[model samples]
Target: MTIALRRDEAGSGPIVERIEGGGFRTQEHYFADGVMLTPRRAETWAGTHDAAMLDRAAIGQLLAIWGEGLPEFIVLGTGSTQIFPSGALRRALESEGIGLEIMDSRAAARAWSVLRAEDREIAALLLPLA
Candidate 1:
C-alpha cells in the first residue's frame, strides 16, 4: 500500500512525499526499508525495517548518526501502527536528554512535515509501512 504524505517541495531533511511499500519516498530519493533523518542530512538506514526489533540498543545505533550533536528529540515511526517502546528505552533516551516520540508511520510523516516546515532541530527514524 502507498500512503501519500505531505509534499514539501521546499523543506530540508525528513520531508516525506509518500510512503510506499517497505520504504519511504522523498522528493529526491526513495529510502528502502528504513531511513534516518538528521538536522543536517537524511540517509538510508539498513536493517531497521522491523519495528519489533526496536530496543534501547537499536536506538543507540541510530543515534550514532548524530555523533556528538544530538537532537532535542527523535521521531520514531513504527511501521503501520503505533508501537510503544520499552520503558527502559524511553528512560534511556531521557537520561541522554533525548525525547523519544513514537507514532505510526503515517502520523510520523505528517509530524515530520510540520516540524520540517517549522525548521525544528530534530532527528527521525522511519520504518517502512509494510
Candidate 2:
C-alpha cells in the first residue's frame, strides 16, 4: 500500500527554506493567500539539553525588529524540549520595561503565530529545531 501526498494550503505562506548540505543555503519564496506573510530566512543550530547554549545573536535579531515597538511582553524559545530564562537576561529586559516568558521552541513558535495573527507586534525569539 502507498500513502498519497496531500497538498495543504493552510498556513502555507511565503517560505524561506534553509538547506544544509556541505554548507548552508537559504532561499526565499512567496505564497499567495496563505497563512503567513513575507518569507524569512533563519540559520539552524544544534540543540542541547542545556539552556546555556541558547544563541544570544538570534534573540537579539528578533528584539531589534520589535525594539522600537517596546512591547509590553516578549516570548523566547530555548530549543529542544526545555524552556527557561537566565536571570541576568530577564533582569535586563525588565530594566528595559519589557516582560518576558520562556518556553520550549515548539510552544514559542505556536504562541508567536497566534499572537502575530492577532495583529500585535510582539517580539519572539524562537530557536528553530534542527
Candidate 3:
C-alpha cells in the first residue's frame, strides 16, 4: 500500500511515503523516491541505502557509524519470518542507546509507515526472502 503525507505535510526533507512488495520477495519499492531496493543483506537508514546485513559485526559497524541523527529505535524485518538477533547484537544496540524490534517484512513495512507518520525517529533494516 502507498503511504504518503498530504501535500501540505510534505516537508523540505525526504520522507518514505510508502512501501510496496512483500511475501518471500527479494525486493521492495519505496514510493517516496520511486526506488526499488533489494535489501538482501543490507540496511536502509531513513532514505540512505547501504549494503549491510543483520549480523554482530555488521551491527557493531553500523552503530559506530551512527552519528547525532541516530534513530530512537530500529525495526528489523527478517525476510519472511521473525528472526531475533543474538544476545550480543541486542546488547550492542542497547549500549548505543538504540532499541531494536524484530518482525517479518510485512509487519515491518506497516510499522515503519505508522511510525514515520507519527514523526518518530526510526529506521528499518529489512532482509527479503530469497
Taking the tens digit of each residue's C-alpha lDDT, what string does model 1 give over 1-130? 7878755556676577887876888878998778888766677877656676677778766788876777889999988899886788788889988898999877887888888777787888888776
Clashes of each: 0, 0, 1
Clashing pairs in 1: none
Native-to-model Cα distance after best TM-score fit, residue 19 in candidate 2, in Å = 14
- For candidate 3, give the lDDT of residue 125: 61
True-structure lDDT of candidate 1: 0.80
Q: List TM-score per model, in order.
A: 0.86, 0.54, 0.58
**Alpha-carbon RMSD, candidate 2:** 8.1
Candidate 3, residue 126: how far the Cα is off, in Å: 1.2
RMSD of 1: 2.0
Q: Which of the numbered candidates is closest to the native, going by highest lDDT?
A: 1
Candidate order by lDDT, highest to lowest? 1, 3, 2
lDDT (Cα, tens digit) per residue for candidate 2, span 14-83:
2222212211222342211111111132333333334564444434544554424566676666554555
Q: How much is the lDDT of residue 2 in candidate 3?
A: 33
Give lDDT: candidate 3, residue 21.
47
Across 39-88, the per-residue lDDT of candidate 3 in tens digits comes to 11223433222223345566544444444466688777665577776777
* Cα TM-score of candidate 1: 0.86
Between 2 and 3, whose TM-score is larger? 3
| lDDT: worst 10-residue window of model 1 | 5-14
